[model samples]
Target chain A: MTFSTDIHVDKVRALLQAMEAGDERCTVEILDDITQIRKSELHQQLSELTKNLHQTLDDLDVDTPVLLHAKHDLPDITERLQYVLNETQKASDKTLGSSENTLGLLEEVGTMLEGSDEVSKIQPLLDQASQELTNIMLAQSFQDLTGQVLNRVILIVTELEESLKALIERSRHDYDAIPQKTQSEAEQSAEHEKGVGPNVTAKSKLDAVESQADVDDLLSDLGI
Target chain B: MQINRDMNILVVDDFSTMRRIVKNLLKELGFSKFDEADDGATAWPMVQSGKYDFIVSDWNMPQMTGIDLLRHVRADEKLKDTPFLLITAEAKRSQILEAAQAGVDGYIVKPFTAATLNEKIQKIFERVAEKQNK
Candidate 1:
């Protein structure tokens, strides 16, 4: 069944108009209808692209598992994306207050340094303030480290999506593997819901235990 | 037991930072015969070519991840005997069991120290040595 973009466009326009009108309640039914329609169309487009890839590349002998891997990587990536989002929220909450305080310290140090009359009296105090600011910056802002790592991850994930398209173009093969990736991602989320936050980096409130023997076994397993 | 110094090693992970860290650690472990693959899909062909003796792989990679690669290696007759170790952030019970079931030589969770890496590699070799002797 073909979905006319025009209808979807009109509904979206209507939805935006409702929002612009300061309508507090955008009915759930209306939202669901728009989402379902949009998703179906998106999936259809995806299917078409897959078919195009198959017709173009799979006929050739080039191995496209890399491409297929990228395709299948989406679900896990989406999960990871959500995780990054959550972590970013947590990180922001933890650090943003301290970060602003550190910046305020910067202004204070600058203001004191610029004062000519009390230079000798304030010099040592200013020096201590500067040092404290640096310490706070280091403690509060992982901008240079985790920020860089997370940024790189985001870029690579985006590249994987683009590369999947290119690999399909290069191989002309539709990767049947994409769905498997999604299925695996679904399994992971389900498992995590059952009490294992496998990919979680932050210390959790959950009653999960890390055993010393398990760590020992892990060491042994590492072939050390 | 091929004591081939020429035997290549493939380090598989989507993260270049991780790949570098693992490769450096492996280098320190006296294994310079090495190569890098971004993920399992990329590493498989190298393994299939019978050119690699060792695989130090990250479990959570884009395609053909460490676990998947180890499984593939275990399932394939020619590659089955090759020593495969998993380096990952994933240290869940079922995941570890799954890797063990797939015949992984070792599993190293992330934020691992160099000492930890060395210990794991030594244990793997000792196990392999015992098996060969038997």
Candidate 2:
């Protein structure tokens, strides 16, 4: 079994040690009391980490993929998120282009009427034009608000960037603590072809949740 | 064990995020010579055309896969011995075994960090150097 920094609470660790050494009375209750608090704590950290990482990603102008629910699934979410970001940017660009076109039309009309003595006739036309101008100005004003909202997102993202960097760094440290097998697994893929890709091993991921006790054991078998 | 830092690096994956992540990691590792392809199919011709010294590829991609790409690389008289690393999320014993048999220069399981990449790349370089010595 892998040592969990997560399950490092004194009481829980002690309980696990006590229970592991204990005899047949070792029931689900032992697993429960020791792991319950730690499990909940881990759940909290995961939620917090996800929330922070996503927020930071937004600051970096990244989108959260609709399909991303967990870590093992990042590849899918990253793909979908790219599409989402692409579509969003396209829509935003279209909106800005439409607004710019309206502004251009208004500018041309204003320029044409600049020296006309038909100020009275132009006055009524100008009234309609001026109303349209106000609408354009209002729209432009809303654009400023959009820009401000973008800035706020940027601010929050900066905060999350530092947070996630720390989290990843900490995880790396934890990973280093886990001993890896000395044997080389480098040449085996050529010798066999039955398994899928190395990155999307869903079996291990599923096995992660249902059986934490088996996590280290299985990874060792995988030579990781 | 040194990677020719100036050599062109190709980052291939169906996921743009991963491509970006790998690129960024490469940049962080002080190598900015890079390009990207979304899958091995799209990446194949580029590898054929470009003088790529290092290729960091994802195992599972849309058009072509890392294994097929690796085989293609080994088959090519010109591209042989170029470093080919497969980075993936799969961690099953079976898949790991398969990648080994494919003669991948190095393998990295996903959700990995910059440091892990450093370790794998160094090990790959060392292996390559050892073989060259022999």
Which candidate number would show the highest TM-score if scored against the true structure? 1
Question: What TM-score quantifies how close candidate 1 is to the native fold?
Answer: 0.46
C-alpha RMSD for every candidate:
18.3, 24.0
Chain B, per-candidate TM-score:
0.92, 0.92
Question: Which CAPRI category fits model 2?
Answer: incorrect
Go through the candidates in order and give each one's DockQ: 0.08, 0.11
Model 2, A1-224: lDDT tens digits are 76666555675666667667874355456567667867887899999998886566444311223112222233333444444444445556666677667767876777787778875576577568757765754554454556566555555655555454455444332322323222245544432232243322333343222222233344345443
Badly placed stretches (over 4 Å) of model 1 are A1-198, A201-215, A218-224, B1-7
DockQ of predicted candidate 2: 0.11
Tens digits of per-residue lDDT, candidate 1, B1-134, equal 33444558888888898888888887776778888888789888888999887888887765556777787888898889999887776667666666776788787766577987877777777777888899
Native-vs-model 1 lDDT?
A: 0.68
Q: What is candidate 2's CA lDDT for residue A162?
A: 47
lDDT score, candidate 2, position B47:
95
| Model 1 CAPRI quality | incorrect
